[model samples]
Target chain A: MIDLRELYQEVILDHNRQPRNFRVPEHPQRQAEGYNPLCGDKITVYVHVDQGQIRDVSFKGAGCAISQASASLMTEAVLGKSLAEARSLFEGFHHLLTDEGSGPSTGGDLGKLEVFSGVREYPMRVKCATLAWHTLKSALEDESATVSTESPNPTPSGGP
Target chain B: MVKTEATLVAPSLDPGLLRPDFPALDQKIHGHPLVYLDNAATTQKPTAVLRALDRYYRRDCSNVHRGVHTLSQRSTASYESARGIVQRFLGSSSDREIVFVRGATEGINLVARSFLGPRLEPGDEVLVTAMEHHANIVPWQLVCKAAGARLRVLPMDDRGELRLEELGKVLTERTRLLAAVHVSNALGTVNPVEELVAAARQRGVPVLLDGAQAVPHKAVNVEALGCDFYVFSGHKAFGPTGIGVLWGRREHLETMEPYQGGGDMIVTVGFEGSTFREPPARFEAGTPNIAGAIGLGAALEYLEELGLPQIEAYEAELLSYATQRIGSLPGIRLIGTARRKAGVLSFVVEGVHPHDVGTILDQRGVAVRVGHHCAQPVMAHFGVPATVRASFAFYNTRFEVDALEQGLREVKEIFGP
Candidate 1:
């Protein structure tokens, strides 16, 4: 009983069509690459964090609607927040997209980002919705290493 | 030739009649009748194969060749009979040549380790095509890396056809093996394997054909094809998973070292030294997938009853219909357009990602694969990240192709034309 409208909302599609922060920063303090080898969806997240406060966040890659929109939405959510706030938002967004109990918690402080709450219904697209966030985490933690969602159990048929 | 040509104009068997045999095909998905076009990934099983699996589990569920009990004997007989069936299906010289593996991946791995592992030396070469699946490529790369051999790839044109002229230039004295795909899983390019085999043979190089995508769609006579080794997964051919066949020439199988070591593969066990059995048993060092083998036997029987010629011809018609239907779209660009293609249609819309295409199609109850298709080199060749793949089987119909076309139209609307 998954709702396609919920998954592909107008806002989500708008973000996918023309993503925000879809560029790599000229001079970024931290950056890391994330790869979903399943669908060849790769993203490089670059952040210009100044003294623990996030200054700029952007990404460059190719992926599906969910992944591209998620990346766009993620940049907007974390741009002015502090590193701590960004990390917290990452957790909140991850929870929202993966909580299989009652589906993604839409009514929360997740803000406009709650539009992606329907992604929880499609387990295959969870990876797509979280690709940018994982890269952002990797960029914050270790800029040298690239992040990958190629877990022991890969997505069936390499869903993006 | 006349039979094949005649079938192109008229399908031999009514696909609707065969459709009922596959119980899974009679279901609904996303509130619509499921249109399974992802047979390249795996095919739905027929009732006969399912019944065989059920019968084996209910009546004869015992370890093979280990016990003197009646159940053991029955199970052993059934398992051995399955091997014979596979041997006949592939037109191999003997049942002893058929070795049951976990799947095509394992079968290729077995050959890479058992046959090519020992013979490869420094400066030696293993020639392959640009269109090979990862199953064929990775194992050879691992073996060549360990053995200090280099892998040479034959190029393909924009139409996804392999450049056979380059074969002569690449086939030098150091070339030890020629492993190729009988049918390209990603591009649907059916390689001229007999010609390739003959070329390899002239230079005294043994060849292995990864027939995973070919065996299910066409009549594969290994004897007529003149390949030294051939492998295919059972699940792709409407049989069960965890079961595949690795058929090799008697000379190669007899001389190769055992790929694995365990109880069943051995003739005598000792702390000092243990002797092994002949070709098939020596290679199949496992409590093999007994039920899977029996199910595969049943699947082969189903195919035999339908007749391979009829199935091939029927699928060819479906392939043509699908290709024409999908290729005629406004913004669609087909990735693979080889003249001799099997049941695969890989393509991309102008600005839409294949994943999006797949999602929209899935919403309409049309199943397809969208990814690098484990053929990243092919993706790189096409200069695209991925393409949506709709692979057909004997059970697919023209109606499903229409569904796919309509699904693509919806995708165009979603992304905006």
Candidate 2:
């Protein structure tokens, strides 16, 4: 029996109810739109990068609790990290949610984002958990690129 | 505070007589009995339809319209007889008007390419309603693009019904064809298609009704509807997939060129040119889905035996029962509440995404279609990205509707305060 606990933890639910950084940053340096066509979950990630270090990041969108909470938690995790560190964190977070055979990298730096480790249980929702991260990746690489989960590989240049 | 199943099981619409005919209904999902409310997508096939498919492949499996062999003759007879069944089912004057296609999507594409494409000139408009499924919308758009014509959309009111008064504003002398859905798949709003057809006819504009969602729920007579073309998927009507009927006026079928050129469509092929078969055969290129057509014929037969009037009456009860049951739930806002609607309950729960609702409902073994439902314009009209659609079939019961209510409560509990 697949546990709903693995999909919707209290921490994730809390973030969903009261998401932080859930606004489009005013005077943002970079912004990109992420669209999940399957469930019509649309998230736009805005980042302010200063001297190769991530200064501030925010997102605004309508989506499922998992996606909204993931974005909320993601913005907090990548706020103070450098661009390179942010990219590594994205990779680690993505691996934790998608890489089923390999154990989750939730112990180290993911911290509050580790609440999403349970997302791996539902394969269909992996896209929801990663939608905000993809938009953030696109924002870091090209501010204008629209990231869609429909496109298997959207703009190869979308990573640090 | 949802009532338990024992308490909730009051006297209401039950599948009863027709439930046993469909084997798929008697199954378990996740650990609970499956309550399939996603009939808008596709219906569970009946035993008769399944048996027809098996009987065709086991006994009379051969390429249709050719060969002196016994099996070939039997296959050809069965295929042609299925066409006759479709003709009688639609109340079409002639069997020649019915052309077999992949599904409604392919049927619309065929008409758009063959009938409408050649006739359309630059600045000519194909008037479509806002509530059309992508099948009805995209094909016309493609034809319009190809023929240098504009695709004009007829607006819908807030209640999800088409603004009939606005139809005259859009229907001009330049309007070549009017394609609209008989029933909105996403909203369940039954369009006043007969009136719409009459209005279009007054302007000398031909009409095509996307009966994909209508045919299964209600009795659709193309002759009475007075539409130039009527298309529907077999799967949606309890038949097999990969088979659909496109019934067109005899005049249009004769005048329009074939959509595709292949072996069966053509009568004779020379180095210079090839002469095609008349009407139905002209459009049905290559070997058709022989088994699928036969199965569809059986499905039509099954529905006929059950009686459309009885099914319609029972389903109306189910729809109203579902509407009230689902609507009464806290934080659950019903999307489509048109004056006239079929058995579809589209809604959004407060503070819960439709996908989350779908997941929670799925865990409770109740199936429903969520998201834009291939009617993004309808979604745009409602100003919601998506909605959870619980569409009903005649086989659906009041008990199933109650189960949907209880499931929604579970969703509310998970996401509520």
Candidate 3:
């Protein structure tokens, strides 16, 4: 059995150590920030969409290893998928982290997001891991313009 | 005769020799040596306190004051004896002045309700420091609203030290009370309670000190400081939870009304109207935490034997060493720089959020408190939402400080320069 203390596996820490696409886009379509001020977890989600398919994705900010690694992994999972598919994964990951479902394996194609199932046991860290997804969801909604690391208020739509 | 100071004549207590007293210190965390640094929040109970907890429940368990049975008598004796021990520890005038509440929060709330409720008038102002824990802040809000009193703040500098000049300006003829922390749990700045109380006393305004952080770290005398009220939690002082002490002046305790209506707190209850018990009994209304009280008393005895002065001397060295090491790290910004402090370091590394620093530290088996620490006012003052706080205890050593430094260094190497 995996030691409970080593809750974040070596792979997750490695991803956090060398985060993937941890930069703002050279030119971006929509940018949104996600913050969990209680734990001081902050992240900026940047997205690029062309028609229905996600053209590119990137993120920047700092938080716990779970959050940074989850953002890295999230970028890899959602890069080529449609906006609808990305939303579905976000929902599926939320369900997995909150332990609301019977482990979303056969139904929702959560991809590498399934590696985060162990996060449920440590409820405090769940917010750390989900910070990125919340940021990504803001970008997908086509509403929020700037993501703040200070406030938890969900961003209003991109429109006036 | 002058009361003898415990640590003044006592020799230094070795943390190594004392390590075995606490059972939890022996455990490992994250494949490394467990370095528990979160003591300002609460301390790990020593074996003596643990034994007291068990012995009371297993052997001497019974209702107090009411029963004539042997168990009840034994339990009552132990409970009252514990109160006497706490009374002496706090330099209280008498045991009757010490009332056990839930914790420091409840203690502050009790005074705000019982004492402040009767005297405060409309437009009278209650002064609180910007560094107050939500516990200290929220209770005064209730009292202020009830009496139509205004609540003002004693501002602080960047280091979270109370603005004494602001305090002088704030305390006027209209000021009723000045309630502030003896030590900031988030920042580790130790307030000069003597100076603070002296200023308030000049204007005849009462001062209530939140001594939650001060009691465990150093010697505290209510009379010497000349504060009207002092409060703290048992868990923070190496005792069991669910029990705390509130020490108020005798006159105030006698004048204040009873907090709750129940069994032991009543002298005589009538069908026409209820007659309340006097002073402390009037305030404490219910079956108290008998075993917890016994544990608290034992905890005090343990501290006495170890000698608080030696503990203070040893912890001061630890704080200095830790402060120096933390100050040298690249991109690490220390938040509070008060001339005097307890054992807390609240800081955030550049390009890294406080949560990230906390997680990184946890990976190395160093436990610390992260986030606002229930002091959002301080956070707001700093213009940040939270901070990563590493609070030390008397038992913590330089090795733990080294481990924390190494952990942060690893975070720096991983994230950026």
Judged by DockQ, which candidate is best? 1
Worst 10 residues of 1 chain B by lDDT: B1-10
Fnat of every candidate, listed in order: 0.58, 0.56, 0.39
Ranking according to TM-score, highest score first: 1, 2, 3
Q: Per DockQ, what order, best first?
A: 1, 2, 3
RMSD in angstroms, all models?
2.1, 4.8, 6.1
Report per-candidate DockQ: 0.53, 0.41, 0.25
> lDDT: which is higher, 1 or 2?
1
lDDT, residue B144, model 1:
96
The residue pairs in collision within model 2 are none
- The superposed Cα distance between candidate 1 and the true structure at residue B195, in angstroms, equals 1.0
Candidate order by lDDT, decreasing, is: 1, 2, 3
Q: Candidate 3: what's its TM-score on chain B?
A: 0.96
DockQ-based CAPRI category assigned to the predicted complex of candidate 2:
acceptable
Q: Least accurate stretch of 10 residues (summed lDDT) in model 2 chain B?
A: B1-10
TM-score of the B chain in each candidate versus the native B chain: 0.98, 0.96, 0.96
lDDT tens per residue, model 3, B131-233 = 8888899999998998899999889999778888877688889999989899998888898889989999999989999999988988888989899999999
lDDT of 2 by residue, B1-417 (tens): 212232233333347777998999999888888999999989999999999999999999999987899999999999999999999999999999999998999999999999999999999999999999988988999989988899999999888889999987999999999999998999999899999999999999999999999889778799999999999999999999999999999999999898999988998999999999999899998999999999999999888877666667777777878888888878888898888888688999989899888878888899998888988888998989999999999898888888899999888777765
Model 1, B1-417: lDDT tens digits are 112454755337788888999999998998999999999999999999999999999999999998999999999999999999999999998999999998889998999999999999999999989999998899999999999999999899999998989988888899999999999999988889989999999999999999999988888899999999999999999999989999999999999999999978899999999999998999988799999999999999898888887888888888888888899999999998998888899999987889889888999999999999899999999999999999999899999999999999988987886
